[model samples]
Target: MPLPLYLLAVAVFAMGTSEFMLAGLLPDIASDLDVSVGTAGMLTSAFAIGMIVGAPLVAALARNWPRRSSLLGFTLAFAAAHAVGSSTTSFPLLFATRVVAALANAGFLAVALTAAAALVAPDKKGRALAVLLSGTTVATIAGVPGGSALGALLGWRAAFWAVAALCLPTALGILKGIPAGRAREQTIGGAALRAELAQLAMPRLILVMLLGALVNAATFAGLTFLAPVVTGTAGLSELWVSVALVLFGIGSFVGATIAGRLSDRNPGAVIAVGGPLLLIGWPALAVLADEPVALLLLVFVQGALSFALGSTLITRVLYEAAGASTMAGSYATAALNVGAAVGPLIAAAALNTGAGSLGPVWSSGFLIAIALLIAFPFRAMIRADSNTEVLQ
Candidate 1:
């Protein structure tokens, strides 16, 4: 609802594009960098590792800074990292740049969400967060496909350059448009913060984080290799792969929107439905690899289910970590990134085994199925949020 939320969305769009565009660019990167495709996939893992570590680390460093300053600082660093990535010709240099970019991305995401929440009324907090997060979904719709097309027409480096250029405007928007709001009060600190964080070790909280990680890992395993999978399985032309990406983005948008709407009233239902749907979608895509129409449709379904699970999973984590809500979101963010990093690593390993393109897809489906089973035993614990202690 606030202009700040929209600005946050823009920041997220730039980050999301940089985060995901690599999937589409992997084929090009591998060839140009003189590495195998499997090796090039480490780019995604490197980015994820950055996020996994950066969210809390950056949040801590900027904990006392003005919200707008933190957001702008992180965004500028993000843009600069992309610029460095665009110029680098070496694989190790490129990998290092991705890690730098991801750290900026993670800091921006953590602060942007906090800033967005600060801008809204208590009743509208969820809606505000949805608006901020929609940037990533919108990135899938526009940035990812657009980056792929640009990479196809120009070069993969061009995609990074474009992302770098896009970030400047977002940084400017944060500076000139969003107000420099005072920091929210730190009601809990020292021993209190330690106690809150310690609750993260509870079985229920651990299970939820594990579930989130597994879902992300499953989704990204196939996603990181989507270019090869579709091209190999459905015999798609380069142009058609972009088209499929658009479809996948559309599904992600729809799924995230639907999940956001249902999150408050029926989080359980969202999980029950989305989890199984993802499990079904992943394997169906693998088994029906030869069917072009099915390939297209399944990608959409997989995208939807993946985000649906993501939305619901975050909600569950917040509930479980009611005593440390802010840190909970950051921790959940890290967990998701952990999955993002590990999933691709596993998929790359499979690809190197000569398991072919379908191997990652099927393997991801199995992981999703395991996540669903894990969810059931923890259902009551996840639902017990109202009884939990508040932070401070």
Candidate 2:
């Protein structure tokens, strides 16, 4: 509801768009570079790796900087990344640009979330997160499919270029709308962040972050391979497959909106529901649906549920650490990015091997199961702590 939230959303929109658009660009990227699809897939891998590497480092480096300056600097870096990524000809150069984007991506999220949390009241912190995440959700619908069309008509470079164009205006909006001084991070906050982590490291909340990362890892692993899953396994045409992805994006966007609201009411339920739907959706792709409509429905539900509780989980971490909120938030962000890196690498390997097209589904089902298992013993602890109004 605040102006800063909307400013963050614009930045998030560009970030989310760049992140998801690469999937749709893979074929074009592969063809242009004369590489295998598996090889071209490195773009996704590179980005995740960048995120995993950049998140904590960026947080630590920007620890002394004001949040506004951190984000402003982050935006400039992100805009450059898109420009480089869009214009590069060689694969290695493009890969480097992706890494740049990834670094900027992680930094943007880490900084933005901290800022978003700072902007809102303590009670409605979850909704503030939801507003930021809404940009990402909307990206699934607006960015991924739009990028696909951009690649189709003008080449994948065009998609990146469009993303680059989005950056300028977004940066301007952030500058204009956000309170210049208020948007910055603090030096004491950084030292405080470290101290908070040391003092308030709640085991149960840690478990949730770890588990959340793992569950989402499976989703990423499968998500990265969705085009093949649709076209190869489902026996759909490429064009139709793109259309299906568009629908999936639509579903994910809606799911994210619902999850945002649900975080206030029932984050636990939102997460719990995502797991089962994903379990069903995973096997369903192997033959869960017979009709085209049925197939689309299944995939849509899968995407929606898979990422359903992303903001809720973040909110929980922040909720648990009332005093050391930034540290808790940073750790959770780092964990998720680590999962993003690890999940797809493992999944790509699975799909590349003879494990079948359903490799990601199995990975996701197993990861979600693992995450759930890890979180089981801590559920009561978490509930107790949430009731306590502090995590650590």
Candidate 3:
């Protein structure tokens, strides 16, 4: 992997921290801003909305810009937004900053994936993406936890300031490591652009996007309540809950690494293998939610499979959208965030509607099953593409 790839990962680490760190500071933010917890929670919704809407829109509008310039521009924008967030005491101002920051995050991530792919051979896109995604997994492990701890010690505003500070070096790294004039979007006429959009509407492409959304829905529906499930059902202390999260994060990192390497040869198989693994894992988790050992192991495997599904889906989009790589990447990013936003809501609704702790577990299983069904035709498409590649 090139240094630029790792630098892209650094950028993702900062962005991912911003995305998730708010989960731990919602109460503090509510108290500080003199709003209800529920009101403060809307900051998260704002960020997700920005990512979902901003990614594809920015990618399309900036399709004609120099890739490196877009990358730098988005990175700085993110940092600046965080800087504003760090200074703001008003809830509305903070919410607005988060939305702008997420817009920058969405744009940067979409371009980073395409830029990473552009640096590698066609065959290595999976691994290259895996390398890039490792940053996100690492963020789950380090960045979120670190932010939470920092928030606990200094204050929630300090966490935002910290994220802003981190971005400076990341921006500098991207400037130094990434070559100028690389990964520029291909120029095309209106007719050609329309044809690329047409390709994006294909059943196979649509299936890939749906699969991406479903996979995130399945995984996050369960994950959003991991702490409660572990502590409530397993009768573990709050500390053990943290242990479970770390285990899951470790599994995700390992899984992403392995998935990247395997995706190079057969991203379809990665998904095929991953989907069933998820189906089995979630149900087992429900059954074993009370068993500490079983819960730990299942959470790890579930996390791994979740990330595998994510990497494979991105690879599929790249393969299908050869000419419109950034658009495809942005769509994939937005689709997963859409799922992320939806999954927790589904789980929350289930719990609120008299479904016990086990509700999310079963809900995840059902969602994964739906995703696999959608993936069936997608798998065949990938296999056909593989066979054609072999022949060529």
Best by TM-score: 1
Instruction: State the local distance difference test value for candidate 3.
Output: 0.75
Instruction: Write model 1 residue lDDT over 1-392, tens digit each, in one string.
Output: 86757877887988898888887889999999899988999999999999999976765555556788888888888888888888888999999988999898888876777777778888787788878887888899989999999998999989999998888777777877666874455644667667767877878778878988999999789888999977787898877778878988998888888887887566778887778778888888988888999999989988888988886777677777777755776787888899999999889888856558887888798789888788887776555344554221
* Ranking 1 against 2 by lDDT, winner: 1
TM-score of 2: 0.85
How would you encode candidate 3's per-residue C-alpha lDDT over 1-392 as one tens digit per residue?
77778778888888888886665566568779998644565676678779899987877666566777889999999999999988988888988998899899988876776678787788888788877866777877778767766776777899899888887877787778765654455665677657656776777777777788888877767776665676678998645655666677778788877887887567777877888888998999999998999999998899888888777776666666665634666767777878777776676566655557677778888899998886686467663255322101
lDDT accuracy of residue 67 in candidate 2: 67
Please, what are the lDDT tens digits per residue for candidate 2 over residues 228-285? 6666666776566567667878877777668767765566776677666666676766
Which candidate leads the pack in lDDT? Answer: 1
lDDT of each: 0.82, 0.71, 0.75
After superposition, the stretches of candidate 3 with alpha carbons farther than 4 Å from their true spots are 1-5, 22-45, 66-69, 86-94, 110-133, 152-156, 174-186, 230-241, 264-272, 356-359, 376-379, 382-384, 387-392
TM-score of model 1 (CA atoms)? 0.92
In candidate 3, position 204 carries an lDDT of: 70
Model 1: lowest-lDDT 10 consecutive positions: 383-392
- RMSD in Å for all candidates: 2.4, 3.4, 4.1
